[model samples]
Target: MDADAAPRRVRADAERSTARILEAAEAVLAEDPTAPLERIADAAGLARATVHRRFSSRAALLDALAAQLAQRYVQGLAEARVDTAPPVDAMLRMTETAFALKLAHRFAVQLTASMTPEVQGGLDRLFARLREAGAITAPDPTWGRRVYLALLHEVNDLPADSPMLDGDDLAARAGLLVGTVLRALGGVWPPAR
Candidate 1:
């Protein structure tokens, strides 16, 4: 039992360190894509060697960031509290949640601009699974994912240096994007769902 307990504690510490490294690297990347690993390590309060051990290489970290960003967007859509509104309004609020998550993880947000098919697949799978599980309701599971994918990547691509990024403005734009997508999806959304 003691042997098993020691390993469990070790695993927990490793999980915590991995989270710290991700947070530090993401903050650095948000400001400069070429930020040095040593700076990330310093911010994470870990040795550079530790970061290397966890991530292996620069490409590995970037890959994780992109994948994480896409998945987080889908998850936010599933989890946000936007009930009691028209379906269209709820959809818009969920879009707001996704954008908020992206801006919060600005490093990953950049890669989401050119979201890879693998990331898109994750989004699709999550939407389908959630719909089947009744965690979310969708008239068509594919349609739900398509709408989210458009809002996240295809449509409403913000400029890298867009001045229209103040908190309130960004959110308003997100609502517009959500409204547009819902209308396009054959969502009636007259005054309600």
Candidate 2:
């Protein structure tokens, strides 16, 4: 075997283990935020020592999860085309993307962590554009954003097994979320697709 092969294999294994742990942590913690590391280890089908070796403490694990979530949120924003799309279209896209992310990372979202300033600023700009385009008539863009986020949170808080989260039902749930946000914020209905 090549001299470097063993080290490369070890690194790959470690990466897979870390990913598994994070995925399990998200699911386990979403159901019970106070679940112990042993519970997460069980969920991951990993030895407790392995989990401990990867994350020294629950806080460390949560910090890593938060960082991962932040990265995913940024990517979702980009995929939503928030800057370039028409205001109503952008809002709907963003809502759909956020609904999926929040549902997948319920524990992280429940942490009440704020996005990086740059990402938050981008979202603020999108809301401003929405107002400018008369898609939303909310006097305060901040209020509009809060209302939008709250709606997403409520929707994602539904039981994990809810039919709304299953397959084609996800799109329906997202549409309802967008429609409610639009109505609450005095935005154009049916979102001018």
User: Which numbered prediction scores highest in lDDT against the true structure?
Assistant: 2
TM-score of 1: 0.66
- Model 2: CA > 4 A from native: 1-4, 157-168, 191-193
On residues 1-193, what C-alpha lDDT tens digit does candidate 1 reach at each position? 7779999998999889888988998998889889988989999999999999989999888787777776775565456433333344445666677667766886787674436564455445555554444445566656776777666653346664555443445565675565555455554323241
Kindly report which residue pairs in candidate 1 clash with one another: none
Q: Candidate 2 clashing pairs? A: none
Q: For each candidate, C-alpha RMSD in Å?
A: 6.1, 3.5
Over the full model, what C-alpha lDDT does candidate 2 score relative to the true structure? 0.80
Candidate 1 Cα lDDT to native: 0.66
Model 2, 18-128: lDDT tens per residue?
999999999999898889999999999999999999999999999889888878877877878878888777777777777778778878876545366656766777788
